[model samples]
Target: MARMPSFLKPPKKIAKRQLELRAQLWPDLNEGDLWSRHTHDGFSTIPSTMALIMSIMDDLSKNKPVSSTYLELWNRSFDEGFATLAKAREIAFHSGFSSERAERTWKDRLKILHNLEFINLQSGASGPASYALILNPYKVIQKHHERKTRGMREDKYNALVARAIELGDISLRPADPSPPPTPMAPPAAPFTFPLPAGSAVPPSPAAVPSAPVPPTGVPTSESSKV
Candidate 1:
């Protein structure tokens, strides 16, 4: 049997020891209002390393930290991997943008996040940012690091990688390339009406008989000679 690589193995003992220490230091920690996804009615699961991810996102943006905005989206998202951002004003307010330009500021942050590939947007009845499909942040960060994206903080990326390795997270790996689009079948030949069985072909315009013309000086049915 092949031996598993040490680097790939999770630190079980260390994690257990940390948990024991936490229990000792805060015995009533579990009794507090700490929310758990399993027990909570309204909660969304997010990565444990979200703080680091947010910092990385901030670095990539090269502007104000957009962590609050991202968090708001996450909070609104369900397990379905998408979020309805119909209440743009509410999201903006919650994301700490309470000024007259709050919504605009939120939109700018959304654009930054979109450019970084963290979330995909689609316009809907609500507005331009009506719907947001959250991407795997780990994969996004990994790709950015691989591509050497400008403004990506190496230290934060390295920490994220180490944490992912410790947690045996597969999301850090690249996804399989999507299959090429199927070619569209040629537009069906213009529909033609099938001739009915035993039906004769219709005569051409020239073959059809036309009304006879009266001679230029001759009286017709409407005119009588006296």
Candidate 2:
């Protein structure tokens, strides 16, 4: 095993950075659960598998958003084949894992993920089969709905609409809330005649002006004070 090149030295304060990154990446998914299941306490498989998936997920997040109005995605695929397996093996080996364990993890762990429907699988004719799932379409729907409910941007909203249409069967429209009953105007008070043209509203009797009355006693019989 040749020594790692000195020029490729680890960064200063990398431990804190690594911890911060890990916290950001796996922030108490559900108290104890991380986003990925294989990352549980009993991780006997090659650690590289989880690392690879996490890296893929990060890449997917950066690239293929549910709907990208601002970005042109640099889409990448995790194909199932010799090259991918070899890469996993290499990561595991570099992480102080035995080659046999790396190979076993490459086979066994990914099968678990596939069985759980975490990855989409496609059969290949005379070629290596492939599997993928960066962001689950259902999860994407949930996330987009949350965004819309919380007020997403117009461009993003339009992109999501386009993507929803592209997806065909997946409905992005919220359930019609049976619109607020059209607010019937209380039958318009059942008027028999049309209102008069100007100031048709009659003043209340109390609001009408009254004539001024003479003083109670002093002007009762005032015939010009004769």
Candidate 3:
């Protein structure tokens, strides 16, 4: 078997640094759970953060990094594929972000590619060089096509909309006075003594009245006289 590189070897210091960086990155990550999973019983002071970093690193090293959003969209059979930067720019413009901010957000993701050593630093093109997720080579090609398909074609989209209306593909717009949903019928009036079919809600029995007992011991005055 070939020997592994020393730099790539897991070092105690690097492991600590990895944990520190991750803590800074995501403070909410459960440190105890992560440490227990990676290290046995937190006995080792070395940062368990490296364990998490290496998990992602191992995936990349194995050439099994997950798919990029752009690539995933290309694989879908939707008539409209993924968006290009140009289309994204239009969306950002409509969404009220400055062009520069939108572009910067995109370019920043390219730093991950540089970190992974996938692209040369000198490449004049500035976009995401690599994606966090692994994608098949065929899918990468498909993504390129998808981006092209999503190019800015306002005229074409408008024409398609008109055609759809003519073909009765679109529904008529409701009147402005359309009533609300009737408040969901007030939750079916709750279960007011509602019993299932054939199961009569047994009527509450009436209170029994005390019977009047005649005075048995004492005879009437007339009877006594007789």
TM-score winner, 2 or 3? 2
User: Model 1, which residues run further than 4 Å from truth?
Assistant: 1-23, 26-39, 174-226
Model 3 stretches with alpha carbons more than 4 Å out: 1-150, 171-178, 183-226
* RMSD each, Å: 12.9, 22.9, 25.3
TM-score of 3: 0.17
Question: Candidate 3 at residue 96, lDDT?
Answer: 36
* Candidate 1 backbone collisions, by pair: none
Model 2, range 1-226, lDDT digits (tens) per residue?
6665655445658857976888899876465443433233322222222332333333333232212110011022222212122244544344334665654544343443344333444444412323334334334434534655333345544564565566463545656778677766665566567677785687767876787888756655656678
1 or 3: which has the higher lDDT? 1
Cα lDDT tens digits for candidate 3, 112-159: 333443322332232433213322322222232335433324443344
The Cα RMSD in angstroms, rounded to one decimal, for candidate 3 relative to the true structure is 25.3
Error of 3 at 11 (Å): 80
Error of 3 at 190 (Å): 6.3
Q: lDDT per residue, candidate 1, 108-200, as tens digits?
A: 999888888999999999878889999999988888888999888888988998898897887775579999999999888888889999999
